[model samples]
Target: MIMQSLRGRLFLGLTAVIVLAGGLGGLLTYQWAFDEAIEMQDSVLIQIGSVLQHGAQSAPAETPLAGVDSDAEVVIRELGTAPRGAVADRQLWGFADGLRTDSLQGRPVRLLLRSRPDGSRFAVAQQTAIRNEIAGELAFRALVPIAALIPCLMLVTALVINRSFQPVKRLAAKLNARQADDLDKLPVENAPRELHPFIASINGLLERIRLMVDQQRRFIADAAHELRTPITALSLQAENLEQLLLSDDGRARLASLRTGMSRTKHLLEQLLALARYEMGRPGKSPLVSLDQVAKDVVAELLPEAVERGVDLGFEIIEPSWVRAELVALAAMIRNLLDNALRFTPRGGHIDLGIYRQGEAAVLQIEDSGPGIAPADMARIFEPFYRGGRPSGDGSGLGLSIVKRIVENLGGTIAIENIQGAGLSGLRVTVELHHECDARATGRQQAPAAVPAES
Candidate 1:
């Protein structure tokens, strides 16, 4: 547990040290104060005895002093010349003229005995328990302030520690809020001197990673662009070969070659598209109509849906607008529709939606196709990750491209396996920040019903 948290360990260690030091200091202070109090009280007893010895002849026999009374617990007793009082007084008379501790009436008392000029003796005494009580009270009063100050010191220590860790917390927040492609160096200004080295190290690492990613993206883009020409030329040559008269088996082989070439061309095209989006920045965010983008993508792909006997159309389209680059928005919608059409089986249907909900503009695509498996759901958006049930002529880069575009546009995408009675399919939902129209009211218009294309 100590290894898991630095703040916990520091706080606990400091608290223990403070408590130990404070406790030891308090013990020493109490002892010193108690001893001083005991000495001061002894002096008072001696002074009282001295005053009585000089004044005992003028005062009445066995009478209390004017200032000092019984309420003060000072007892003055006159013993006859031969000590003819109680057993305790007789015991006091046996001792020479000095202070002693002896039991008076079975209770401990401190006594100071002195004789007058006429040989008459008087004793001044106070209870041992009362003397000790006063001393202890003084000692404890000294401890009260220390006791109060310890907790206050602890509170101040905690506040200072928390304040000192604020820069670290703020640094973590900045890193977490950064975009995927953001590899900017962390700022060291205003941070603690101790953290400057750590921040510099992190900035160096980010710079290295940014350089490495740039190299990889450039390599892919260059390779795909270079190979596109030769692949197209080979496809043209195969098309030229189709004009020659050949046997039935040769014709069958040519068709297979054409299919392989087409698949390769598709793969290269996908690679190029992925590289372009990853390397190119979406410069400015402009207000674009989400419904119009989705409509255009649907129209472009409608012929493929017709050829495969799949019904494709918009189920809901509202005049929703979002702040995103025009090309990015079109690419996001096109990839989504392309993936849906490629997966949806013949005679199945693909539903499209674009509407504004609250402060977000949403685009949804649902297709009547085999849903993704539970195991593959986690990696479905990863580049080139075709699942176990890989179907159709998919290059597996469509969803990855869409995810990049959506992220660049500051939007979110969610994929879920649709489940119901006698129905199972996939649903993809994207939500972007809605750009409200200043000319219209706050409320959005109802969705326009569009019929499915044959």
Candidate 2:
């Protein structure tokens, strides 16, 4: 069967208890009344016997007892068989049949009698209407109090149960009134202690959802702002190319248009990559080596470094291993290295180092370029936030993508300017949780990195 709501269910349970109690109480009351009636009847019988015994002893000896009814005469005759001075037999069998017969017929009677020396009996019989009257009155008196209390008991039980359920009802109403965006923590004061943990867990989930929604909104706004300039540049360049035929500057305009298109494509690709990094795939992370990732990134950028006459170097600080998605780790390292290469002056030097620090594996990239100003350091990791409009050749999403990847791997990334180390470039550091010996040995065989496109 379909279950009822909380209020109805509680009412039903309490009503059942009340009904059971009422039934039991009624049964008990009936039993008590029945017992009292039996006791009263027996007491009346005993009193009648005592009165007859006393009358038999006190009656005048010479006069015949007149006005004795047939039932009383029979009892007196039986009593006359007893010795005069002996105690009367208290056994009720002799008169029990007559008493039951009289009671059934609604003819109540009492007798006083004694036996004479000649085996005859004298007796006086009286109608006992008062006995029946008292019994009826006592039954009415006993039942009246109990009958009055039943409704009162039920009313009191209902009130107590209703008061006890008030908190649950209030909680339900409060929840029902809430809106979808209402992610604030619930007010738990005066709430049932049993429901507190459930409320707390709901609040936690809502907080996470709110944070994610806020992040998505920010990402969209920043992506639009970043794409706007490149798109506008491409559009204007196309228009200029269209008019170049009249000015005999078609070839130059075509080159500029091509450059604009390239920039637009690069920005779009970066946006897609950042989106993919944020929407991470669910699975077990593949085994990856920090040393191999560093090597691949350095090898991919070697040609550019050579053309610029800049020295690019990689050092393995610790022969350790990590578990991560290889493609994601490569992208993360490539972005950081690409950023360094784009900004560093020709003939400058760049160093990539991988090492273990405590329980973490670390990657440090230091480039000999113009260092970031202290004021602009914090915003450098923000998506599409270029520092002071430097060369437009680089999409500002590089460091942001790097940060995102590091975070996805359960790692942290930080940047700071190197001081007094014969280099003025920015130093970027990434830290990842490393596997211990048992897990590391199981995946000791290194997988080859996918070679980067030329």
Candidate 3:
């Protein structure tokens, strides 16, 4: 997981290198310094031995040098020519006149033996322990800088890597902040030079996607436009058949044909509606009253509701305005009311509400009917997707169109089954952002809870 991040990988790799180099260099320098110090101490012993070789030397019997180890002082002892009873003294006498390591009074010491001009052999000796203590101190001082520098270099490396990757972070942040409708190409000028090719490739892909979407929308609209005339003529021909004398069976079949044709025409209109919004043509004048649109749709649809023996009325109303295209908003509300009317059994009731919810204008409509199945709820908004519930005289594009319109206007719509109240029903809620108050325009947006048309 640590290797997944570019910064982490770089930091770990560089830190490892810095630590390894410091550790190895410190080890090598300590070894070199220790050897050098030892050699210098050996040279001091040789110099003292040479001085004693040219002069008369005598043994200091029954007297020992004090305060030598406390001061890190070399233990220099002279062993003159005498019958040596101690094994260490015998071993020292057996050696040739040069520096060597041997025991002195049962302790380790470096011995440099020399013969003076008076024919008395002399030995200059220093404790090996005191020499090693001085050498270790010098070597440790040499490694201090290397030990301290590794962490400092690691910190600087982290800062440099983070700064270098800021451009990538900025690019990601910009992409994340864009709206779904925003398809503009990302600017490559401010990005790092190495990222130019990648950015250009992304821009090219976006252009292709934009062109593809445009073609798809244009195709649907053009096809719908071409089919409208023929479908209108067909409707007229079907109506003309209604005026002709025919058998009862023929009349029933004729009615079925007309119903199918009407559904087809409505389907085509829905396809055209979806295509129109897909092109993203939001009206320039976006200030519209949500409550007024709902009222108008209710008034228009009331006669149909009456014919179906359904009861429709508003539960609450308020001056709720939104920034929206007038026709699209009307289409959305009409579709919602139509769905409610179609599924609602004869004599069922539909309750509508329009009110302000914080910064949003909310539209809530609930119908007392056999609500849609829970399993089919997720796919209810898909184009031409009919659910398991019995849907009468619909192309299944009504909710799809409403969804598209709501999305295009940057609003939200949610449908859920009504629980409790011993009623099988569906409740739909839509919330649209309010950009300005309708009272400011003095348009008398809507009154509260007016009666539904009978």
Best model number under lDDT: 1
Model 3 C-alpha lDDT per residue in residues 132-157, reported as the tens digit of each score: 98999999999998888988999999
**Candidate 1 residue 160 C-alpha distance from true site, Å:** 5.5
Ranking by TM-score: 3, 1, 2
Give the higher-TM-score candidate: 1 or 3.
3
Each prediction's TM-score versus the true structure: 0.74, 0.49, 0.75
In order of lDDT, best first, we have 1, 3, 2
**Model 3 has how many clashing residue pairs?**
0
lDDT of each: 0.82, 0.68, 0.81
lDDT per residue as tens, model 2, 43-107:
54445445545544544432323443233222322434433533332222134323342331245
TM-score of 1: 0.74
User: Is candidate 1 or 3 superior in lDDT?
Assistant: 1
Better of 1 and 2 by TM-score: 1
